[model samples]
Target: MNAFNEISKSTAAFFVQAGASFGVSFLGAIGGIYFLPLDPWQRLFLGMTVLFLVASSFTLAKVIRDQQEASTIRVRLDEARMEKLLAEHNPFSAA
Candidate 1:
């Protein structure tokens, strides 16, 4: 149950971050189209730049998220190792 809750929370957070990043990128593209006065080639360049930025943002977010999740897993493993060591050290328990 706790694991399910954690999964749901992480999934929700991921979607929220993705949605927000996409929304901002879209708005930025729209704003650029409306506000920038440029030639055809310039507009094309701007469009490509915006696309690259959006893609980069998503990739960066995923990388950071994976790093954080890995860190959490490492911490949990360390905790379990410590617990096992403590158990082994207990004089009252039969080995």
Candidate 2:
């Protein structure tokens, strides 16, 4: 039910490895495009396309994360309301 419980902490080494992998992949793509014997206009278009893809990927990740957070919050709210109702109930009361 806690935010901390939902997220596991990453070790420094793991964090570094992830970052390095991403950097290598992105740079490799760009470097490969740069070395190709194509016209400048073609290279520029490829570079722009790659950048746009990266941007869209980031945006998509953010959207997914936000949706997950929203769902978790909604579940927590519903749980709280149920708990409050349970706490206020009197089983022996006569109506």
Candidate 3:
């Protein structure tokens, strides 16, 4: 169990670091391309940039959705706990 926990933590940290690095480098590339001369090469780079942005946007949306679901679950758990406490406080309240 200890080894599993450590491995999980390390893997999560690695992804976090990788994501940050990728984000920064991706932004830098997009910025650099803006100053490139307008030619077939520049157009190709722009097309690729748009594709990357679209793909990342889709991925981010899915992450947001999963997070939203998790948040809802937490909210429901808290509500259940609160109700349990309330019932304990008032047996006749018909909670």
In terms of lDDT, the best-performing candidate is 2
Global CA lDDT computed for model 2: 0.91
Off by over 4 Å in 1: 3-21, 92-95
Candidate with the larger lDDT of 2 and 3: 2
- Which digits, one per residue and each the tens of the lDDT, describe model 2 over residues 25-84? 999999999999999999999999999999998899899988987897899899999999
In model 2, state the lDDT of residue 76. 84
Q: Model 3, range 1-95, lDDT digits (tens) per residue?
A: 65434543547688899889878877777767776778878768796977788699879989997897688678978998999988779656666
> What is candidate 1's lDDT per residue for 1-95, written digit by digit as tens?
66734663757688899889878869977687757888878888888888788789779989998898788889988998999998879788777
lDDT values for all models: 0.81, 0.91, 0.77
TM-scores, all models, native as reference: 0.71, 0.87, 0.47
Ranking by TM-score: 2, 1, 3
The collision pairs in model 3 are none
Per-residue error at 36 for model 2, in Å? 1.0
Name the lDDT of candidate 1.
0.81
Best by TM-score: 2
